[model samples]
Target: ALQRTPLQHEQSDILEQQARDEKVALEKATDQGQYFVFCDTAPLLTAVYSDFVFGDTSLYPRARELHARYAMTLILEPDLPWVADGLQRDGAHVQKPIHLKIAQELRGMGSLHYRVTGSGEARLACARAAVLAGNTHIAATGWRRTI
Candidate 1:
């Protein structure tokens, strides 16, 4: 098995590679005529994480450019229970702060985004409504639509 490097010790080269990989995926999806590419994560998050952990801004330019290509971004809250995934996730303690940073970054870029909350079916319903409405600004109720 390949040795798993701890996230904190992840090198710049690997991080850059991850961002490039994400870019390729996004481009491939767009080229394939995928109208709605549902990425569970993206370079934006990678940039945010890198900045948060290593105080690096190298990924921001590329991340911001890629972020603008998205029609909408659904920022899920850390309301769900935390499960350990070794080297992938930090901990529940970091979720809120990281989430806030993501929102701040989105707002800074003036990207269309929404903060999604709730669990299970309710969560799905909220996200579905946001996507289906295709509204620039989803009204605040259980979710917060931000521009």
Candidate 2:
């Protein structure tokens, strides 16, 4: 199991205390990870629009430049059984069973790794099972943990 230092627990407590809602708390929790902020469709669209309207028409380029500056990987997750109008990108990974193979390819390409969570209540059950199984490291949609 991953060891959680007292400081880490304190930080988690502080984040939970300060968050306005559970979603905010979850995001804050994930922020504690080395590579956090895996962008989903909504945030990406909001960011694109914010930059396009208020900043520059070359906003996407500028954003990519900034991401490159920070050496951050922009990972796209469309969820499995891909839906139409979902976020599409050159390097985006589809959320289908076949996409598992695609994810392996991307991992080989040094893009990013991926995992599929079970559906509905099963998802939470899976997470709890992982925790019980002594899986210290975990990264999921709304939460991550090293404990």
Candidate 3:
């Protein structure tokens, strides 16, 4: 088990508190089923994905372990491609498509319901689409909606 830094511990505490509060709110807001969307800045993915790609292959095992514990839909959006250090050709990062990478990660995860949509109108359209398709939770960058 990795020991969390002070800041990491604090962040975990805050997230735990928020999860509890959201659970209560979700219970009150819906009768049939509840959907919880966790949204945060893309830096979270930048850090984790970068580590998973560039660091030792052991990092992937840790990521899988963490994912199993959470069991929520993960949507990864980064400004660059997740390339391991030795795998990248010169300047390949410049042309890497973030949306494609996100879609790939979603597929690799395999279990959770996941998709990649742009942050603006496309995201809204995707949300509407999910609602129409009967998804209980729609999570995106800085946006959470229940429909």
TM-score of each: 0.74, 0.26, 0.39
* Each model's lDDT: 0.72, 0.35, 0.43
Model 1 — which ten-residue stretch has the worst lDDT? 138-147
Which regions of candidate 3 deviate over 4 angstroms?
1-34, 41-48, 51-53, 69-102, 131-147
lDDT of 2 by residue, 1-147 (tens): 114212322333323332324345445766775433333322223224333234423333333332222112323333434444433221323133333433443454443232436666766575455443322223332333331
Task: Give lDDT: candidate 3, residue 127.
Answer: 53
The per-prediction tally of clashing pairs is: 0, 3, 0
For TM-score, the strongest prediction is 1
**How many residue pairs in model 3 have overlapping backbones?**
0
In TM-score terms, candidate 3 sits at 0.39
What is the Cα-based lDDT of residue 74 in candidate 3?
45
Task: Tell me how far the alpha carbon of residue 88 in candidate 2 is from the true structure, in angstroms, after superposition.
Answer: 7.9
Candidate 3 has an lDDT of 0.43
